[model samples]
Target: MRITRGLADIVIDSLCRGVFAGDCRRLSLRSCFPFLYDAECSKRSVVLGMVAGGDKTPHPDSPLIQRSKKEKWSQWSLRGGMQTLSEALESYIKDKGVEIHKDTPVEALERRADGRWQIKLPDGSVTADHMISAVPAAEMSRLLTPIAKPMASTLREMSASTVAVVNLEYDGEVLPVSGFGHLIPSFEDRAMLGIVYDSLAFPEHNRRSSSSTRLTVMLGGAWFESSVGDPDAVSKETLLSLASEAAATQLGVKEKPRRAIVTLNKSCIPQYTLGHWKRIDHLFSYIHQHSLPLSLIGASYQGVSVNDCIYNAKKAVQRLTGS
Candidate 1:
C-alpha cells in the first residue's frame, strides 16, 4: 500500500498533473478519480479494489464489450476535427426542434414565485419549469447569487486553470522520435504542460498534398500565474517562441514552422481541489432543501473528459424524465 518517494512522484506527475492540470496535493482524489476513491472506500484497500472489483466477465449482449474483445483499444480521432462533432450535434438538435440562441449571453437568472426558472437575456427573458446549467462554476455562481447566495458562494470557490494552446506545422517531419507526446512535471520548472504529436497520431488530419508534421503545445495550468504571467497580457508571439524552444530542446526540432496558431482559453479546465466532493455534496443538499429545479452538470461537478460529460448528460436527462 505504501510507495517510495520516487514512485509517488512519477504517479503524481504522470497521472495527477497530466489529467487534472493541477498538483496531486491540491486535487481531490474523490472528485478527480471517483472510481478509485469509491473502490478504496468500499474495499478498504486500493490495490485489492483494483484486482477484485474489475469486470471479470463481459456481458454477452453488450456490443461495445464484444467489439473490445476482438479489437485492441487504440487512439482515434474525428475526420474533420473536434469542431465537426459540435456541428453535427447542432444539426441533429436543430432537426429535433431545439431552438439554439447563439452569442446571446444570459445576464441574470431568477426564480419565479410559481416555481419556474426565468433567464434574463440582453433583449428579453424566458421562463422554464426546469433548467440544466452547463456553464462554468464561476458564471453559474454569478447567476445564482441573487437567488441562492450560499450555493453561489460555494460555486464561486471552485477554481479553474487557464491554458494556452500553440499549434505548429512544419513542412517535413522534424520529430526525432515518433509517439503520442510527452508530459512535463512541475518539478521540471517548465511553463509547458505537455505536447501532442497531432500529425503522427492522426495522419488523416494532415494535408493530403504535402507531407507535413503538426504539433500542439499546451502551456499554463495551475502554475500559469507564476510561470507564464497573465494569460491576457501574454502575446501570441511569446507563446509561439516558447513552443518553438520547447520543441527544439525536447524533440530535437529546429526547423522553423511553416504555419503556427496560438489560442488562449481562460479558466478552461476546472480544478477539483481538496474537499471538492464535500462542496458538491453541500450544493446538492441545498438544492434539495430549496426544492430547486436547477441541475448542474459539466466539468465543474463531475468528470472533465468528453465521454464523462456525455455520460453525465444522459444520466441527467434520465433523472429529469424519470426514465
Candidate 2:
C-alpha cells in the first residue's frame, strides 16, 4: 500500500511480461473508461473497448475471455484498468478500516531472545510480540544479519519489472480512433507497449464530454528496462511517438497534447511464476522454525491484486494472534 520501490517492482513485473513464466491470471479491467477498482458505483466495465476494425489490436487471449464468459461475466459490460498503487491502497484502507502513518517506513527490527520483535522508525520504535516485515524483499533482506536475511534474499532474487504512466491531455481532438484504442502485442518491435484511449475508455472525467481528450500510454518491458532510473524522459518520448502515431495513423489530429504529465513507477509490478510459491513457502517455513513474531504481506508474494493483499493480511494477522 505504501507503494515502495518493491511494490512497484511487483506490479511492473506482472504487467510487462517475461518477469514470470506460464499464463498470467489476467483480469479484465478493460473498459471504455476505467473506474478505480473500488468505483463499483460508477457502472463501468473492466475490459478495453476497442473500435472494431481500426487496428490490429491485441487483447486478452480467447482462452481467457472464454473463461471470463463461462464464469458469467457479461460481455456488454466494460472493464476497468489504469489503476495506480495509491488508488488501490485507498480502496483497501477504506475496506479494512486501517490508518496509515504516511512517510513512516520501518527502519530496523530487533528480535528478542525471548522471541518478540522490536521495529525501529525515525519517529519511534514499536515493540510487537511477533513481527514479520512486508518491506521490499531486497531491503528487508539487507537489513538482517546474514543468517536471518537468506529467506528475504530468496524473495529478492525473484525477478520484477516497472511501468511508466503517461497522461497526455490535448485541448482539441487528435486521434481518429474510438473504443479503447490499441494494445501492442509483445511481438511488436516498438518501444511503446500499450495505448489506452482514456477519454473514450472512461467517461467519468469532466473533460470527457469535450473534444479534448486524454490518452494514457504504457511503455514498458524492453522500453522500460532502459529508462529504469530516469523514466520521465523515456515516458515523455514514448508519449510523443504514440501521440504522433495516433494522430497520423489513428486519430488524424496531429497537434500535440496541450499538457503532458508522466508518472514514472519504478519496479511497479510483481512477477509471479511457477516456483514463486515454493520459495515463499520455504521462507515461511524458515520463519516458523525461528518462531520470530513477524508477518509479511502484499502483492509481491501470494497475490498481486489489491483484494489479495488485504485478504492475505487479515489471514496472516488472524494466524498470528489466533483471531
Candidate 3:
C-alpha cells in the first residue's frame, strides 16, 4: 500500500486528532478543518500551459488523513493520476511477486485451525496466514455475516454518503485560480461541493496541440440525492448548470461545453463521526479474539481519502504478515 498526500503544503502531521478531539479544539475546527479550497483540477483552466496558482488546500485537520504537508491541489492526467497512485502499490506487490486477480471478487472468508484464513472467490479459494479486506465497512459487514451484527450496528450509527463527479469539457481556456478549485463549506448549503480546474492543473491537458480541456466538478455527500432524482438527469443538466455557473461567474466563458461525462459512485465516501475510534477498537478486539485471520479494509473504517484507504490497508497487511 502507498501513502500519498494529494494536498501540496501538508505532511504526515497530527491533524486527525484535532477532529477526533471532543473539546474546545474540535469546536474551533468545525469550519477550519473543512476549508473551502477552490484549486485547479484541469490544465485548460490556465493560460499558456502555465500552472495556475489555485489553492486545493484541504481543511487543516482531517479525522483520517495525515497532516504534514502543504495543501495545494495539483493537476492530474489519467495516466499521471492513476499512475502516481498505483506506482507504490505495484512496487510492493512486485517485490513480493504477487499477481492480482483483478475483476474476480471474493465471496467468503474461512479461517482454518492452522491460523490461516481462506478467501473464497468465484472459482476457488486462496488461503493465507491472514487476509486483509479493503472493501467498504458496509460491504464487509454484509459479507462477514457471522460478525455482521456488531459491525452493522456500529456502521449504521455513523454517517456516510456518496459523491458524484461531473466531467465538463470545453473548447476554450479557463480563468486561472491559485492552484485548482475549492471545496464548498457545509455551511454554504449549496448543491455543488467543489470543483477542480482539471485542464489548468495538468500541462498535458492544456497542450496547445490538444483540441480541448476537460473539467471535473464534484458534488459530494448528500448533494447527490438533493440535486437531482434521476441519475441520468443528474449527469446531464444538473452538472452542466453547476459547471456553467462556475465558468460564467468565475471564468467568463460563454460557449457551452463541447462535451461532458458524468460518473456517479454509490457509497463513494465514508463519514466517520465522534465514536469512530472507540467503535473500531471494539470491533477489532472482537476480530482478534476469534483469531479469524481475516483482514478488513476500506475507506469506511479509517478514512475517505485515497491515501487514507491505502495507509490503513497497509497497516492491516503489516499485522497480518508480522512484518
Best by lDDT: 1
How displaced is residue 55 in candidate 3, in Å? 22
Candidate 1 backbone collisions, by pair: none
TM-scores of all candidate predictions against the true structure: 0.93, 0.63, 0.67
Ranking by TM-score: 1, 3, 2
Tens digits of per-residue lDDT for model 3 on 1-323? 11344321122112321122112112222122322112212343323122464444434345323323344333223545676668777779879999678789878766566767678899887878756777777767666665446655665555445556677777756454546555544334335566666775665646476566567776645545655454444555665677677666655666788787767766655555555667777678777776566666776665556655666676777776688
Q: Where's the lowest-lDDT run of ten residues in candidate 3?
A: 17-26
Q: lDDT of each prediction vs. the true structure?
A: 0.84, 0.57, 0.56
Between candidates 2 and 3, name the one with more favorable TM-score: 3
Question: Model 3 TM-score?
Answer: 0.67
Find the candidate with the highest TM-score and give its number. Answer: 1
Residue 221 lDDT in model 2? Answer: 45
Ranking by lDDT: 1, 2, 3
Candidate 2: misplaced stretches above 4 Å? 1-100, 145-147, 172-175, 208-211, 226-253, 321-323
Please give the lDDT score at residue 143 for candidate 1.
93
Better model by lDDT, 2 or 3? 2
Residue 269, candidate 1: alpha-carbon lDDT: 90
Q: For candidate 1, what is the total of clashing residue pairs?
A: 0
